[model samples]
Target: MGSATAQALVASSSALNAAQGITLDVAGELFSVGRLIGESTALSGALADPAAPAEARTSLVSRVFAGASAPVQDVLRAAVAERWSSAADLVDGVEELAVRATAIAAPDADIEGELFSVSRLVAGNADLELALGSRLGDGEGKAALVQRLVGASLNPATTLIVTSLVRQPRERRVRRLLNRAMRIVSAQRDRIVATVHTAAPLSAEQRSRLGAVLTGRYGRQIALNEVIDASVVGGLRVQVADDVIDGSIAARLADLRQKLAG
Candidate 1:
């Protein structure tokens, strides 16, 4: 996001945080608005056009989202009032707000874990990934597939988030979109994601210990998402934000080969 868009998001988030009645319902409404804008190039262009006056864009939002609740309207108004880099960024910003709002409404839920589980499921199954991420596929059909896959297990917040992303992936890969959602959920809880790739699944005890070590190192709580990669051979590769700790045997072997070649 550009500086202006980021500033707008922060301001809007602060307002939502301060509001008393913001709920998952509000987030759902925002998601609906985002989907509507994403599917309609004309609407997105009008809302995101920097050349258009902010008042006009907001007026447009009020008309298009007339039935949205006050809280939802507040968010949409704030979103459309900002200067976006492009029409697509406007949609992306709205979708991001929807995810964040869901996270805020479901503070006690394990939303980050749920999003990660869905991402892993999609990553492991090529057909499922294609079905959900396919641009040519019907949006409703993709939503139905998401419902069948995880609707029963997830909370309404997770369901809305996953369904919205799958239905309108825009230019994002499904796994990438889910990962971004997980990060947003983690940020809502004042935590960071620690993705662990290992040859075998870690025991609960191992996971706890790793979490403790990472927490001590980063000075923040970690939400661990484990990926079982047979190619790892041994040890693990840990990624916390941009910092990576690659202790896997595969990495070491590759380093040794590079040194030999040098």
Candidate 2:
């Protein structure tokens, strides 16, 4: 997943940095590039496009995000500039790097969350999400659409992230990478997340009750991500690793049917 990839990059960079004594503050620029890539399918496709030469692609990224931190540009060149082969792969690489850098820049903060969340606000809508993340359009169209929607004067860090991903693609889903990064970071500090699915949106009180129940049952603090799935039919399904607590009406129906058949 994206988080694992980001962590791998982080590990690689950590070793590389330690060996070469190259330290960087890449958060601002990394964010810039990550944002740009997320906003532009064309940019993502272009970066990963095999037709373009690596040097040319790297130069394009640098030119587009000229205002980003110099260190970030260096990191881009080192991590993805020459290694990317497809659009998806490049996006993944750039995104992973940005996620990692963002985490390091604000170790105890929610910078990555803020970045991804706000982006979801803009690109989260179904139409835009499909346009940006889908395979319906070619690379150029994706870039143009992104620029049209985001405008040219975005923050440098955001721009860098977006543009780099546009040019260099990743193989994994962007959200997955980000989530994994957040999870790994949180786990290191003893924070774990559990996703809760419901037949419909849960009330605040319900979420609170679920959280308390899950905490008591699991014996560990948990963060709940609520999702609505009408098919679940009036019950909850808490999924944490191999565990599943199905309180769904659907399950009850199946049980009843089985009993009748017996």
Candidate 3:
């Protein structure tokens, strides 16, 4: 979140956006490098250490990611050329770039929806979430589990994002990782994600009107991912980024109870 990390991410994002052909391969390679750095404290530290010479860092990238594709090596070189806020931030930046590259490769894919579905799936299954997010478990095992569960049904971008997250969670929960990935995918499409929770599913007309209203309010097209939550009672709860518009009766009752008690 520091200036250096932000600047590095922006530069890397532009590079990914400008490149064409072999993007999917680039994404895979970046994900692999990110995972490697994320799991290795020493390697990450060596790359992000400001005291070290830039050439040394670049050389380290060349040595470590030497087998990666030329495009991937180029990305790593660009990434290491800049200073990072922390070792962790370096890993995060690489992972974010990987996700962005994947999104760019599959411009027409509904990656946000697929990510949301995976988040909900993990949230609903505590054992599965624990298994995948367990720090004690093998990263490859978790990745294999994701592959087996998703099979070929998911979009390639979705699969890559999920696999990368499962492998290098970096102390994040599965749900948080998926939400972040969803936001990244949404930004790639020049849209924002709105999670709408309602007692029942909205009709097509209702969905259209809701989307229109949200777009007007947010000044951007909204992608609605509807969730049927009976706890919402008679109304809806919508979340856009960090903002929550809770019109649900459940929220109202809770607010009223707190006010009356006070």
| Candidate 3 stretches greater than 4 Å from native | 250-262
Q: Taking the tens digit of each residue's C-alpha lDDT, what string does model 2 give over 1-262?
A: 3554455455535532333212224654564576577668887777656577878777877887788666776776565444454555555555555545544444445433343443554445777655566655565565566566653554433433443344323344545543555464445334556667787888989888887888888787776766677878888887775678888899889999999999
Q: Model 3 Cα RMSD, Å?
A: 2.3
Candidate 3: tens digits of C-alpha lDDT, residues 36-99: 8887999999999999998999999999888888888777878888889999999988888888
- Return the lDDT, model 3, position 242: 86
Q: After superposition, how far is residue 206 of candidate 2 from its true place, in Å?
A: 3.2
Error of 1 at 244 (Å): 1.4
True-vs-predicted CA distance for residue 78, candidate 1, Å = 1.6
What global local distance difference test value does model 3 have? 0.88
Q: Candidate 1's residue-wise lDDT over 1-262, tens digit each?
A: 7877777777666766776676888888888888999999999999999999999999999998898899888788888888887888788888888888898888888888889889888988999988777778788889988999889999888998999888888868999999989988787778999999999999999999999999999999999988888999999999998999999999999999999999
Give the Cα lDDT of each candidate: 0.87, 0.58, 0.88
Better of 1 and 2 by TM-score: 1
Model 2 alpha-carbon drift over 4 Å, by segment: 1-25, 31-97, 103-129, 134-168, 171-189, 216-220
Residue 175, model 1, lDDT: 94
RMSD of each: 2.2, 8.3, 2.3
